[model samples]
Each structure stands twice: as C-alpha cells, then as structure tokens.
Target: MTDTVTLSLADLTARVETIFRRAGMNAAQTRALTSVIVAGERDACKSHGIYRIEGALRTVKAGKVNPLAEPVLDAGEGTAIVRVDAKGGFANPAFELGLPVLAARARELGLAALVINDCTHFSALWPEVEAVTAQGLSAMVMCPSYATVAPTGGNKPLLGTNPFAFGWPRADAPPYVFDFATSVAARGEIELHRRAGKPLPEGWAIDADGNPTTDPEAALEGAMLPFGGHKGAAIGTMIELLAAIMIGDLTSPEVLDYLGTTTLAPFHGELILAFDPARFAAGRPGNPLARAEVLFEAIVGQGARLPSQRRFAARKISESQGVTLTAAEIAGLDRLTAQGLDAVA
Candidate 1:
C-alpha cells in the first residue's frame, strides 16, 4: 500500500462534501465549509484544512451550530454597512451571502463593512480577504476566537487568538496579503502539535503557573501568550471590540462561556471591511494599482518576501499536480465518511 495518495482538488472537494452531507449538514453549510476547507488544503494551510473537519462535525453534533442554517443578508441599503445573520451557522456562508452587496457598497461609497453575526467561526481569514481582493477591493478581516490567550502582564487566558488578515488588490498578480493570529501562534497549531506528539516551540505558551512551557498539553490547559507582547495583545483587544462588541455579538470570553468548552468551534461574529482603492485614491498623482506594483517591486528588490507568497506557490503546485495526503490522513477521511458524526468524540 502507498504511504500517501494524491487526489485532484475536485475529488478532494467531493469527498469532503460527502463527509459533511452525511454528517447532516445542509447544502449551504456543506458547500461553504467545503470551499474553505479545500482552499486551505490547496494553499497548504494544514491547520485550517481537513484537520478542522472533526471540530465542525462535533459542533454540529453538539447542537451548538445549526447545520441547516440558511444565511440571511441585510443589504443595509443606502448605508456603508452590510450585515449577514448566519442564523447560528458557520461564518463562511454568511460572508458569501454578504460579499456582493459589500462590494457594491464599497464601490459606491469608497468603503464598506460587512458584519457577520450569530455564527460559528473556524478557518483562516485569507479566503475571505482574497474574495474581496478578487472583486478589485482591498480587504481587512478579523474575528475573535474562544478565550485561549493571555493578555500581556496577565497570567490567565482572557483573550482570543484573534486572527486578523489584510489584502490589497493587484492588477497582474495575486493580491498582497497577510493573515495571522494575535497570539504567538494560532490555537489550532498547539492542538496539531499535541496530536502529532510534538512539543510546541518555546515562547508559544505558558503553563498554568504562568511559567513558559513547550508542552502542548500544558499550553492547552494554561494560556497562550500574545505575539510581540503588548502589541499583539492590543490588537487582540481591538478585534474583540470591533468584531464582537461593535457588531453586537459575543466576545471571546462570552463565547467561551456560552459554549462551556474549548473543544467546540467558537460562536461569535466577524468584521470584514472592503475598500475600493481607486475610489480612495481618486484624483491622486498616479494610478493606485500602478503605484502598488511599484511599491511591491521595491519591497521584492530588497529581498524581503511578501506575505502569502509561499501559500500562492503551494496553490500553484496543487492546481496542477493535485493535493497529496498521507495514508493516515486518507484513513481518517475514510473513517469520517463512513461514521459521519460518530467519527468524532
């Protein structure tokens, strides 16, 4: 038997879709979830890839998320704010339902904000960022996770990892993009390390006693530190304010309280801001897109790599050569497909 198997993206998507469908997810949930999961695999973002399937299934089985949710969009006509109520479903479909209206509002008013409420959130923000960028708009996306990180100068977990992402549209290339958690690393990375029987890197987290630790289990029981100390902590706080509080959704602490366990996916809100660069740069000295290319060239000339370059490279390879999964991963997929929700604890 082979140690690994390579499947075309379509095949992988079909398989993932089947798993979700069999797990009782409705078409909207399954399709949106599958898109983000497959995109994560295609971009080689393993933490956000198929590895997230069980958590989602568990959320559904626990009745914490509505698998049959059909997102509702409020165009917020005549305003710069668009809203989507996820109806207690996953955030992906909510974002999708609001994207077109958000783009339209941004083009008309130079900027717009899409607020996604009452949803369970997983997956990376880059997919949403890229979606906006593809519509010829710059994007900033952020959302709060379950409380798993410590605020600077604090010992206990009080803040979410709080992922934030930005994307700038480009005329002849992939958009310039960066996505990262305010924590030293994403909570999912620690979970992955634990599953793989590997210790986390130093400084990633602290033990319950507030001492630095590399043990993934201890980290899970303890608190993850903010990246860049106070700065990351501040950013995390900002996400809690804008994505959760301002959106009138549950903050990280509230989310954790509501779910009662970190084992399930987070139920919160998301903030996506879209900007039409051309509109913002109207009557400027040079074309905004052209100026951006020049800036990119200068940055590359300095030998500093741009963010998401590696992901885009991996995506190119996956598009042409297909995605490869280890035998163990394939077996896991088989088990999930066969057992559906029973595949998870």
Candidate 2:
C-alpha cells in the first residue's frame, strides 16, 4: 500500500504558495492558484489537490502558460455581460477579476453573464459558483476544453469533460452547491488512478478499439463515456456552444488542434451566470434564502443529503485532523523546492 502523511491546512497553503512563487508566478497569481489547491484538498477532492503541481510546473516551464499573466475584463455592449481575457494563464485569476464585476452587474440588472476566454482551467468548478452564491445571488458556471469525452453513440472523443456548477443561497447554512462533469469520470481522476496503477469502474471508459476497459491507462488513451449517455452528451454540447461559440472563443476541436503540435495548456473558455433572486421573488412573501432554507430542511427531513454536503462536511474534518498526502506528493514537493524548475521543477 502507498504510504500517506498528513499536514495542517496552514502548512499546506504555505507550501503550495511557495512552490507557485518558485515556479515564477506573481504574488496575486500564486494566491489565486494556491487558494484553489487548498480548497480542493480541504474538500477531500484528490483529483484537484497537490497532484496538479507537477503538471502546473510543466506547463509554465514549457511556456505553455504564463505564470505572471494579468487578466483584464471588458464589459461587452452592455452591463449585463462581461468578458475576461486570462492572457494565457490559469483560470483562477481570471475568475477572480471577473466575479465581482459580474456580481455587481447581477445585483443591478438582476442577471449577468461573464465569458472567460483563453484560460487554462485545471480545478473543480464549485469554488467559482460558491463565490457568487456567497454574494447572495444564484450562479451557474460552465467551461469547455480539449476533447476527452465521447458522445453517446460513438467511441471517439468529441467533447471536453465539460464541468458545470450551480449554487443557491441559503439563510442559515452554507450555500447549496452542485458541480459535476458531463463525463463518466473527470480526466484528473483517471490520471490519478493511472499513477497509482489502479483500475477504473465499469462504464467509465472504452479502449482504443471501442471496447470497455478497467485499465486507467487504456481509459486515458481512449475516450471517456458520458455520465448519463445521451443526456450528458446533450449537456456537454450545450456547454460547448455557450463557452465557445457564444463567447466567440475556440471550440473543443479547435483546442485539440492547437494541442496537436504543442505541449501547451489548452486555452479554454468559461461561461458564468449570476442571478439576483430578488428580481424574480420580490414582494412574494419570503426572500430567496429563507424559502431555500425551508426547502432544504424539507429535503433533509426526507433523508436526502444535498449536493456538496459531503464536501462541506469533509472540509470541517480536514481542518481539525489535517489533510493526508501520499509519499510521492511529498517527495515531489521536496524536489521542486530543492531543484527549482531546473527541469519541470
């Protein structure tokens, strides 16, 4: 069995931030990226935790991603929509720069959308949605990337994993958060399994010959099946259009084409929407959060655990007990600290 070690949340954040800075990221960029990494770990999301550090360093060293990118926002045509240019950097800073603007616009006009272009998204989508929800607005965020998932009737990959996240405000509890990928499994999960020499579940993927396989390596080499067959495929298609065509950004196929000749971060596009419930529920008896609390209570009374409830619970435990990390991850961090990007540091 693989050995595991634990670290406090504060130590984890400092270590990650130091590594990012050593990789040449500016303070703001480092903080943004580190926050996501720590949040992933806190939520017990192994796919998005420190395992991503090696890939991140590789992308920066190869000049595939700009470590010190400065994102900018442009409100297009009206205040209801805004576009953020991530400048070939990771998605965190771009989302950070655009969220407040989008939240403000939603508060004013009742609804607003933010289109993020040319960014590398390598984490869970829930954080962005949660940020918007914390502002007392409902939110939705989706993004398309390099093709990795096959459509319902075919075996070849034709779409990105295509994550979608939604959040609703609640009065006496944390926001209701739901985030999922259209594929049977996220690409990061497959990568993690492959690294650990583990087998995937049935129906998670098909081999190169379009045959099902439990081998994580084969699954990665071939195509991931959609989560719910045609239904997931349809949602993936809609996300592709909204995140790419609607934003006048490159589609999944286009992103794959760019990746064909370079070891670069696939600059993907993200689409986000924030809604002010007050606009719709104004003068209707109770506010959105109060009504949502009642609904949540009824749902919980029925013994239903809402989406992201497990994650929130995990975060509390992680804070108290510290996060567990594999021996390999600790070694990798040490190598980065000692070597300092001498290769893919």
Candidate 3:
C-alpha cells in the first residue's frame, strides 16, 4: 500500500470543513478557517496547514474562541478606517467581512485601514495580503501573537513572534508579497522541528538559561530570538504598539497573561492597511504599476527571486495535481474528524 494520499483541493476543503463542523464551529468559522487551512496545504506551508487543527480545537474546547460568532463590520462612514469586531471568533471571517469595505475606502480615499479586534488568529498573513492585492491595491498587515520571543539582549520572553506582511499588485503576474514573523524563526517552525525530532538551526532560540541552543523543546520552553537581533525586536515591538495598543486590543504580554499558556491560540487583534496605487499616482508621470514591473524585471535579471514565488509555484502544482499527505497525516485527519473536540487533548 502507498504511504501517502493525494486529494483534490475541493476534497481537502470538504474534509477540513467536516472536521471543524464536527468540532462545533459555526458556518462562518468553519468556512473561513477551512479556506486558510486549505490554502496553507495548497501552498505547501505545512506549518499553517492541517497541522494547526488540533490547536484550534483545543482553543475551542478551552472556551478561548467563540465557535459561533458572526463578525460585525463598522464602515466608518466618514473616515478611512474600517473596523470589524470578530466578536470572539476567528480572524479569518472578520477579515473577509471587512475586505470589500476596506478596499472601497482605499479606492475612495487613496488609503484605508481595517482593524480586527477580539479574535484568535493563527494563520499566515500572506493570504490576507494577497486578498487585498487582488483588488488592485497595495496592502500591509500585522498582528501580535502570544509572548514567546525575547527581545535582543534580553533573557526572557517579552515579545510575540509578531508577523508582518506587505503586498503590491502586479498587472501581469502574481502580486509582489512577503510575510514573515519578526522572530528568527516562527514559533510554528520550532514546533514542527520538535514534532519531527529534529534539531533547530543555531541562533534560532535560547535555552531557559539564556544560552544558544538547537533543541526545539528547550527553545519553546525558554524563548525564541528575534531575527536580526535589534531590528526584529523593534519590529515586533512596533506590531504591539500599532496592532495591539493603538487598536485597543491585547498586546503580547496581555495575551499571554490572559491565556496563561501558549498551547492555545492567542486572543488579539489585527491591522490591515490598503492603498490605491492609481489614486495615489494620479498626477505622477509614469504608471506606478509599470514602474514596479521594470523593477521586478531587473531584480529577476540579476538571478534573484521574488517573495511568494515558491509559494505561488507550489500553489500551481497543487491546483493541478492536488495536495499530497503522508499516511500518518491522513490518519491524524481521520482521527480528528471522527473525535472532534475529544481528539484535541
């Protein structure tokens, strides 16, 4: 018998939807959650793929996330800021509910921001960024996770592995986009390493005593280091200031205190800014989009690759050939689908 199984993207989505519905998630929650989870699998981003279902279920079982919440949007009638109260649900549905309003405001005002509060966000930011870019606008997204990373020169966890992402639209290709955690490595990557019984790369984290280590378990127990030391730490801090503090939402420390453990997804907020390129360049000489193309071509000519290139390529393959999962992963899915919340702990 084969050791792996491949399912069409539709099939995978249905399976994931079934799992979440069985776990007691509402239609909105399950639909949005399944989209991002399946997108992760389609793009081969295993860290955010089906592997995350257990954590989500655990969060639900712990009463951390509202499985039946319907996100409410505030259009900000006279301002460029739109808002979506996740109402204690997952962030995906809130983002979906706000995107059109955010895009409309950006087109009208040249720029706009979408604030999502009181939600549990666990997926990558690229999907949200790409969604904005698909509207022919530029996008910036950021959110604070629970405290698990230490600031530069610090010995204790103070900052979350906050993620930041940016996207610029392209007339003839996939958008130019990049999304990454400010930490040296995303916490999820460390978890994946631990699960595979592999050592983490050096400089990725510190032991409980503040010394460098390659042990994923030690790193998770202690703290992860920020990328580029001071720079990443500063960026992580900025995310707290903007996405958390300024938005009147929970900061990394507050989230940690509220949850008391990192095992469940953190409760927090998100900030998404959209910019209308044409509106901003109305009086400019050259077309901004065309200029961006030239820059991209030059970069490609230098034998350098663009961000999301690999992901888009993987998406193309998955779209045609379907996503492949190891037998073990399939078994895990089956177990979760059958047991629902009981499969979590």
Candidate 4:
C-alpha cells in the first residue's frame, strides 16, 4: 500500500544525475541539482525528496531553471555585507554556484549576511546549518519567495513558505541544528498528498475567498495558512522582507510571472547570516569548547533536545529496516529514469 522504496544514496544519486544530464543538463548543473535532491531524501525530508524530481524536471523541460546558472562572489565587503552576483545563469543556483559562495561570503564578512537572488532550492536547510556549525560559527539562513498564502484569519496568498535555519557550534555530538519552514505546511508536502491522491489535513491552506481548503488543487490556488496563525504570518513576512526587500533579488511581481510560466520555478532572494563564535567566545580561554560540551550533554541527555533528533532516529530505523515505497511511486521513478527496476539493482 505504501509507495516508498529504498536505494543506496550514492547509487540512486549517480543514476539520477545521469538521467538529468541525459535530459540536457550539464555536468555541473546535474551534480548540483541531484545533490540537493539526494540530501533531502537522505535526511528524510520527503517533501523535498525524489518526489520532487518530477516537478524539477518540469521546470527544466519548460526552461525555467537554467541548468547552467553558476554563481560568483565578491569578497571585498570590509565592513558591510558580502556581495554576490548570479553569474548570468550558468548553472542551477543551489550549492554548486550559489550556496557555497554565500557561505564563503559569510566567512569573509565575520558578521556577514550573504544574499542570493534568482537562485535554486538549497534542499534541506539543516545540512546547510550543520556545515556552518562545523566551522565553529553561528549561522542563520532563510529563503523567501513569492506569495503562497494570505494573512492569518484572512484568505489572500501573499508569501511563500519561508524558512529560517540556525546552527550553533556544539562542543560534542552534532551541532545543535534548527531548521523548519515558517508555514503550517510546505507546498512540497501538498504536492506529495496530491501525487498519492490523498486529501490534505485541515489548517494547511485556505480557499480563493480566504476559507480553508483540503483539495490539493484548490489549496494550490488558495492561500497557505501560517503555522501559528497570525504570529507565524508575521514571521513569514519578516523572512520575505529580509530575503526579498532587503536583498532586492525576488519580488512579488516576478513571482506571479514565474508562477504563470510553468517553466521557471525558482528559489531566489535568499539571506544567509553568519557569525564566528570563535570570534566571540574563543578568546575566553578555560577550554570554552569544554564548557559548551558540558551544556550540550546535559540537554541532550534529558532528551529536551534540538530540532533534528526525530529525523536522526528515523534515519537509524530506515537504515535497519529500509525505506518503504509504493509500487506506483516505484513505477513513477521507472518512468522518470526510463530505467525500469534497474535502479533497485
């Protein structure tokens, strides 16, 4: 009954990348795009997993996300923000060309805010946070694009399912990672239910006139409700402001145009903020790292833990028992790759 299947992460990625390249994506683009996809599935964010490859292909087939947009960075911001320019769309804008440059820019700024406009999906935010955390730095990154929902208690789509991710340096175990979308639901989640022919739960979206909706098609056309009603809406708006307004990369008008095109899905106007913890706490001496380690052990020991514990636990289970896949989904993957059941082998 379930439509999920398991495959080795590395093998699945190679085949997926090959398929994308066969579809006309260049090597750089294929690797970048596929890596994000793989990371999502490995981390158990099914919303952004292989389930999204079909949609990503749609955009590619439509020529929306240029598989060749490589990003370039400027490191000379002495006292202000690090500057990045999307290098005329050479490859997809995720980790390959954009996210790395953004992180590098953050390193240069010390207290940096690196922004990327007209970018692609960075996949799961937690990994990104984990990366920055590993560097003994504190970083928060958010991506906001286009409107998908109306204000709380009102029905008028005005913002995307913006997310905020933060990572703090931990002395032991995994660095504390916090990453989640600021909406009640992500569009990716809705797409999953739609693909499986399931109705959505209440409180995820509202209708055209600002009422609630369960029909995925109607929900897609309606406003997405905020996670905490008005409070969530306000935070979502803040993400838009920081990513779009402050960065000046994506705007509402552009979002509407791209939405209509069906070929140009994008994740632009992203803001990445980083601070070097070592710069602040490193000089304190007395093994500052040791002090943080003690605190982390205490918290995780009691199990009042961070954001990604459940996912880690799920991954362990997934590894032991394997992932469950529906026959239909397997068939869909077969169609996408045209490789039949060869992927399983």
Which of 2 and 4 is the better model by TM-score? Answer: 2
Best model per lDDT: 3
Give per-residue CA lDDT, model 4, range 81-125, as digits (tens): 655565433223433343455456555555666655566554566
Better of 3 and 4 by lDDT: 3
The local lDDT score (0 to 100) that residue 144 gets in candidate 3 is 96
Task: List model 2 lDDT by residue over 1-345, tens digit each.
Answer: 659989999999999998989878987678888998899988998767886777777778877678989998896646688889988888889999998889889988899998888887767889899899989899999988778888887888888888888999876677899999889887777888999988998999988778898999888788899889899999999989998888888777778887662234567788899999998787888777777888888999999989999888999899999998889778888888776567473
TM-score of each: 0.95, 0.90, 0.95, 0.80
Scored by lDDT, model 3 comes in at 0.95
Instruction: Give the least accurate 10-residue stretch of model 4, judged by summed lDDT.
Output: 88-97
For candidate 3, write residues 182-284 as lDDT tens digits: 9998787899999999999999999899999999999988899999989999999999999999999999999999999989999999999999999999998
The reply for model 1, stretches above 4 Å from the true place, is 191-202, 214-217
Candidate 4 has a TM-score of 0.80
Total clashes, candidate 4? 22
Q: What's the lDDT for all of these models? A: 0.95, 0.84, 0.95, 0.67
